[model samples]
Target: MLGRIAPNLLIRIAGRTTEAGIPPFVDLLRIAELSGNLPATDPSSTPAALLTRFPHLAEVTFEDVVVPGPHGPVRARTYRPPHPNGIGLVWVHGGAFIGGDLDRADAHWPSLEFAHRGIRVVSLDYRHAVRGVHYPVPSDDVLAGWRWAASHARELGVAPGALHLGGSSIGGNLAAGVAKRLRDSRPGTDTIPAGLVLVTPFLHPFGAPWPTGMLERMRAATTNAVVSPEDLTHMAWNYAGRRSVLDDPYAFPANGDLTGLPPTLVITEEIDTIRTSGEDFAERLRAADVPAVVRMTPGAAHSSMSRPAEPTAQVTLDAVAEHLLGRWSPRAA
Candidate 1:
């Protein structure tokens, strides 16, 4: 028994074991294998398949629009609420930089929820890092989509300067990049979004050290079992394409200047590795004198907000709706 247990002890000593807090519903989803591997070649991972899987989209009122980008035209879906609050949200979907689309379940569910709450949501089907496309391609597409949303706010019936930007996972990183570009651009060139909502955002592709206790627990969590450190490194390479680009603020929002960013809300998962980075990003925003708040959903894993049935997920979505409606208070629970 000692011989058999010695290797296990050694593995733990090597810090290869983590204690992720996986909820029952998430466990039933069996996301471990799916998260561990990139779905670049999987047909089911395509955007079309995502839309087909979620057939209730017709229940909501939405329109598909084409936005012009540097490389080409990018498609985006706009969901309208029956009672408009005059606020708009530009959402981007996550796929580890290589997969995912506007129709992604994670993006769809939240968009519908927000739209129903009276905030118009524009989900961008930005370019991904596939077929030789990488880095700036996706980021540029997101920027174009944002500009279109802002410029056409009048026609869309959304109030100017009331538009908000957001994304999940890598999508969060792209949204942050777009916000930064808007802030850095010539004054009055574009309308800056009133706020940002980052859900379990992948902000630090280059890596950041987590606090000791948090790191140990995050590593031990089963919720993180699907994604290994190697997988993250691989995804980063796919997005950046070159090592030099890794340092680019657009590629890693954590490295960018956080000053002048609009009021921001960063939502993180308690058991996810990216939580540390997301929290740190929020801290940076505060340090830069930007109004920022960070909230963690206990017992939640990466992308848990996509689950509409989960109470914590509902809380997360409600928080987002509040933020978009300009009612989010940093001191509120």
Candidate 2:
């Protein structure tokens, strides 16, 4: 019966009848509907198509570079500003470890936005689980990209040791894992990044217990359409490939040590299931004497960053820019 009904019509009906208010942007519902109508195909091809469909920014310049990944050569796209600021950001795209590419709307737009603000953005096209790859492999690819950017910083016109790392969704998981690796590699050296920018990062795949009121607010924020526990479990299994490795700190950052990470900025949305994990990670960093902050976007859902023009997305972008540019204070958010 549900399959027989139109997606838009179903969305409208749910909006009208549901106790939870409608999601902030009607465009989000439209996107969901459109996605449901698309043919089942290779997830790898989706990002290029999405980039073509959402070609909004034109001021930023982009160049493709191939980095030597652990498995093979990984393609990365660098977004550059007209004027340089001497700071670089290495970004990872999110796709539940099965999908996603550098050209994804969420990844592209944020990189463009940051580039426009004078930060050099390098977005990595890491190996995905769908391609028969699994944990550590994906993270390894991301770490390779980071190292490439760091080593090539002078050529990229970015100052050495001024590189920051970030990602959204699963990309966030990779970024956090990479940061941990860098932290542990050299005990006394300043191998850590300048900072970390995590946007609605999926740091924890396993659901954590949240307060009743917080859960209700998240449900209302997402209109009860967030990722279900079953989907999370499947995604975890697919990415890890083995149940025993799920607890590996690098694979699931929630299980990792939080000490010695650089100053971190964790941005989350009110309605997303990942919000709790991101917030909890920030708390863990603070407890470990790391400078960490959490910025919560009100009434936003997961992947809201994909809709760059939305108010919530705009606010999140501004917060990220301010934090990276050293204008944001921990007490301010």
lDDT of 2 by residue, 1-333 (tens): 333345455556445533343222232233334442212222322445534644544667899989998789988998888777988899887766665566666677788878888898999988767545678898999989988988878888888677899998888899998998888886754356888989888777585556667656566555445654545666677778888778888898878689878889999987877788898999998999888899888888886776654568788888888887778666454
The sequence of per-residue lDDT tens digits that candidate 1 reaches over residues 1-333 is 222223334344334443332222122112222333122323342345535654554356888889999999998999988788888899998767765666565677788778877888999987767666778999999999999999889888788677899998888999998899889999989889888999989888745566667655656664334344545666677788899888888788898688988888998877777777788999898899888898888877677755444557667777777777767565352
CA RMSD of all predictions: 8.5, 6.7
All candidates: TM-score: 0.80, 0.81
- TM-score attained by model 1: 0.80
Candidate 2's C-alpha runs over 4 A off are 1-56, 186-190, 213-224, 330-333
